[model samples]
Target: MKLSLKKIELTPPQILVIGFAAIILAGSALLSLPIASATGKPLSFLNAFFTATSATCVTGLVVVDTGTSFTLFGQIVIILLIQVGGLGFMTMGTLFAFALKKRISLRERLVLQEAMNQGSMEGIVRLIRKVIQYSLTIEAAGALIFSIRWSFDLGQAKGIYYGIWHAVSFFNNAGFDLFGPVTGKFSSLTAYADDPVINIVSMGLIILGGLGFVVISDLLDYRKSRRRLSLHSKVVLSATGILIAVGAVVIFVFEFTNAKTLGTLSWQGKIWAALFQSVTPRTAGANTIDLAGMRQATQFFMILLMFIGASPGSTGGGIKTTTFTTLIGAMIAMIRGKEDIVLFHFRLGKDRILKAITLTMIALFLVIFVAMVLSTTEEHPFLMILFEVTSAFGTVGLTMGLTTDLTDFGKIMIALMMFAGRLGPMTLAYALGPKTEKELYRYPEGKITIG
Candidate 1:
């Protein structure tokens, strides 16, 4: 007698994302119990869920002080949540499957493709392995450097733990920090700022992590052969560099006379703060200066920086550098009456241009809608609402002192934005599953012209 066995199906990306989110929520609830909190007060389930979502999304927006509110175990849970969340749930799932020596299924490859926002599934398995290796290597290096620096500041044991925790935090772009009191205090990083080794190492990790895994893979490949960088890498690197430099210059110019923040700083301190502000807004959520004390113009500038965010396929979130660049390039091309959309000597497809435009519009709309909702529910100014919305959508975690005052509805809205930002609006859309319906008839094209 022949017996047939039924095949088990793997979970879809949406289900997987939700399941992981549930696990994080449950974990946060358990950790928020009286025994796990620093104040010995049990956290409300809503607060715990919000915090869990924020952490899992690698978003730094917190209703409570992470350092003061959570115990060591709770903090560890948040860190782990960030690690998995930053890496993408499917990516971690794939790594576990690989560790078990299990064959990666086609569905898994598709999931990985969606996770990284790659155009193709070819070499996705290899890409996933490389991503894991690269992440570990970078995180380890960051931890080592941080540990060495922290050792000199603190004792060996504390420094070692600090190093490891911060390394994971920075590399993952999760802004949770042990420096609770020092968060808004610029005096905390005074020692580390001058220490070139620590500053450079941390910034280097941030850059590498924010550069996107695709760019890293491309660089690795280019190293073996003296070939040029891929278009994606070129665009990402060039846009990122230009944005950082411009942002730094803008910050330096604007805050040079503030007196409270950058104005009173020495030349070196000013430059360091400016540079940190510029770079950190690229979705790292680490700030050297007091964000609340910045000039309105500077705050607006930061909003733009946070919105543009880091490169695609990276740990950081935003509209992405490439998308911003492409949208600008497309506009320029259109204004010049050019039929072909070309950038870096390569012609961009209409689909790409359309996707970029759509993503930007959707992101903008989401931010605005959430901000409007918050304005109505929370007792904050419109500017503060905008700041909070941008913070959530960018996953930058920098707030203008309004996070704790948000109502339950406002928190949930921001939580949704954070989730969408981290997973990516497009990825979340795709996770709902693609809508594939062929049109039976083509409609007549209508043309309208406007400036």
Candidate 2:
């Protein structure tokens, strides 16, 4: 196939913003069609738009039930959006480009770098190829397992279809689920709270998806070559393990006496639920237990986990594991009266530290501002509003029963929050800002502070 391509003048960040918006809008339109609904009546455009944004952003918050409300076409549309959104539009486009044997232009490479959050254009194309390859293999294995497991209960054909749908959703860190019929509407995976197969598989998919592609690739290569892991991979793994373990412990203790949550489960069930909850908060929205029923302390702890979120270049969103780790490292350096922020015996550059601080600040402000706005627009309690806002900004779908009650204005706000979260607060700032101007001059800095 011969292809003629004209140069696009947009910056990488701008292209990403535009590409994601395009997918969201197109998805919204399709979902609004009568054929997309289970009832054969057109879903309101607002609901359709919200659902599309949630799916494309891979945020699981939903105003409507996924299983009973949509026809097979709508579900298919959603899973496709999740796949494209999770891997990123550029990745899917690159796959097509590879199939067509089209040369990847420098501009396209730049876009890919930004899309994957890679530091350089070098080896970007190769990395993307590995990303797609690894993602498909993982999703296929998950789907086969889910299909076989579900076959006995749902019939072979339904099991297969659901298996594929859920595999895509889970592996993408998108919390969309079709258990609405089996469980109640918006019940998520509560029905499988004690099912080891379901809980284990769901957590496995989420963890793999949350671990960024680069880390995944590095781990795989390390296994083959018996090589030392990259510092980034080491920090990511360390932080991830610590967070999960701590979160599980905290949740287990906090919810142990609460009759509505972990208290009623068997000892083994409680452990599974605790672990699952811990993992899900890192931008994987599938919940095995009732989030609303959990103790407030546990909910707040999960909020912190959600805010730290998944690793960079992964399907999940938030400030990112690396950024959180960097901030903590910087804090430790300050406490120890050291001039350098060190991680794994290596000194971190000022630029990296500054970027981490900037990203966290931007994310924090965005989340706070959105929460304030929702507080005024909706009648929910301040805590619930904050949780909803943080969940949207973190692109984590866990909610305390607030999603269904949101006003139209509130819904739009949450949708925009999800958009910003998925693209990243810093990236959105860059895409919307004027051209960067290099300052040729600098003034001396003076600071006065009291601790």
What CA root-mean-square deviation does each model show from the true structure? 3.2, 3.2
How far out, in Å, is residue 424 in model 1?
A: 1.7
Give the lDDT of residue 121 in candidate 2: 96
Candidate 1's residue-wise lDDT over 322-366, tens digit each? Answer: 999999998898899998888889999999999999999989988
Cα lDDT, model 1, residue 315:
89
Model 1: residues with Cα > 4 Å off, grouped in runs = 1-13, 181-195, 432-434
Candidate 1, residue 48: the lDDT equals 86
- Report clash pairs, candidate 1: none
Error of 1 at 274 (Å): 0.6
TM-score of each: 0.93, 0.97
Scored by CA lDDT, what does every candidate get? Answer: 0.82, 0.93
